[model samples]
Target: MIILVAYDISDPGRRDRAAKLLQSMGLSRLQRSLYAGRGGAAKARDIARALERILDSETDVADILVLPDHAWSRRIEVGNGRARVPGRARPPGVHIA
Candidate 1:
């Protein structure tokens, strides 16, 4: 399973905290506010809940997308960056480990 976590935090402190939390969960940063990792359903839910708790519901927004192996296989990339999609052949420069 692959999990994509993205967040928008209004406060700089909270934003950094959120990034750190995600990193601690073994997620790799894909962009300033985007992260991806591999985990089971339970792990994904736990991470989502943890992120939700760290966020200010009134001011922050976070999204967690779970992609099964099949869904990830259909992903297409066209650019100069790396994408970590588990259980799939990655494009050049892409890293999935």
Candidate 2:
């Protein structure tokens, strides 16, 4: 499953730490302050909790988005489409054409 993590941290140190934490959990950065990761439910949840601890009260705001695997097919076929939402883009990580 793919999980999207978006954060708007004012502290540069905190922001970088969050990004690194996500990356360590197999997240490939999509944009500045945005991360995309793929992992099992337990791992994802654990990572999110760890990040929360790191941020503590310094985080201006953060969001851990758990994406539904059903929405994503095995690969992006010919008819595979895209969707848009607030904050960041839809598909954040590697895409197989």
List RMSD in Å for every model shown: 5.7, 7.0
- Give the top-scoring candidate (lDDT): 1
Q: Per-residue alpha-carbon lDDT of model 2 for 1-97, expressed as tens digits? A: 7776788888888888887888788776656776776766787678768877877565477787766776444424332233322344345324654
Off by over 4 Å in 1: 81-97
Candidate 2: where are CA atoms >4 Å away? Answer: 70-97
Clashing pairs in 2: none
Candidate 2 is scored at a TM of 0.64
State how far residue 62 of model 1 sits from its true place (Å): 0.7
lDDT to native, each model: 0.77, 0.68
Model 2 is weakest, by summed lDDT over 10 consecutive residues, at 77-86
Highest-TM-score candidate: 1
